[model samples]
Target: MTKTYEESSQTGDFLEALRLAVERARTEHSPTDGMIDWRVAAIRGQRGGIAGLNLITVVIEVKQV
Candidate 1:
């Protein structure tokens, strides 16, 4: 199986973390969604999924404040 690729952050800025993740997805030419596991990640907990792509299936998660 192909390994999942993700970008996660814990900078304490929720929007910034989401922004960076979305930017990473587009730059990497991939949709983020389940590509990340934030809790065990560089950040922790689920703030919810922020949609970046046309399909609702694609999402970017942010760290909770």
Candidate 2:
């Protein structure tokens, strides 16, 4: 079965937030079954309010190779 991973990050820099979100997804991934196929399912960004920070979300899908 395929597995889905979701990660989010908030930072003042847009690139930083995206990098953090992707890093989180990679850190949480388990490769127990062997080499796996992975893809980015979605990327979302939103304003975090008065602070002007950005909230970034990344979704990943994975399955055994």
Candidate 3:
């Protein structure tokens, strides 16, 4: 089986946002039913536009073990 996960973050630092997004991708894991492989499905980013912080989104697909 496979599953898809999406996580987004808006922060002043681009790397921090990306790191957070990836860190949030997997909330939990188990030895018997854990992810064996991960593939990046998409990445989207938008400018803060002056009033808001920059937005970064990351999508990933995981293959079950």
Candidate 4:
């Protein structure tokens, strides 16, 4: 299913919030002796309603720090 603008925006916001939370937690609780990276590994989907699928998509990206 195609994502609506609201949905996409919400997802992006959620990811950003999560990244910030993680960074804060790491700074407070974990030692910062090494580099850190946050990334979206993948989003995989196949297109179909009730029968054979016609499309497949997978998105993957590294989050920039």
**Candidate 3 — which residues are off by over 4 angstroms?**
12-25, 33-35
Residue-level lDDT for 52 in candidate 2: 83
Question: How much does candidate 3 score in TM-score?
Answer: 0.60
Candidate 3 lDDT, 16-56, residue by residue in tens? 65555455545543445433467777788887667775777
Candidate 1 residue runs with Cα over 4 Å from true position: 1-5, 30-65
Candidate 4 TM-score to native = 0.30
Score residue 6 of candidate 2 by CA lDDT. 68
TM-score of each: 0.35, 0.57, 0.60, 0.30
Lowest summed lDDT window (length 10), candidate 2: 12-21
User: Which candidate should be chosen as best, given lDDT against the real structure?
Assistant: 2
Model 1, 1-65: lDDT tens digits are 12322444443455555566566644554445534333312344344448332211123443422
Give residue 3's lDDT in candidate 4 (0 to 100).
17
- Which pairs clash (backbone N, Cα, C closer than 3 Å) in model 4? none
Better of 1 and 2 by TM-score: 2
lDDT (0 to 1) per candidate: 0.42, 0.63, 0.63, 0.38
* Index of the highest-TM-score prediction: 3
Clashes of each: 0, 0, 0, 0
Candidate 1 lDDT trough over 10 residues, lowest sum: 51-60
Winner by lDDT between candidate 3 and candidate 2? 2
Model 4, range 1-65, lDDT digits (tens) per residue? 11111112223344554455455434543444544443344443445558655433333232333
Q: Higher TM-score: candidate 1 or 3?
A: 3
What value does the lDDT take at residue 27 in candidate 4? 54
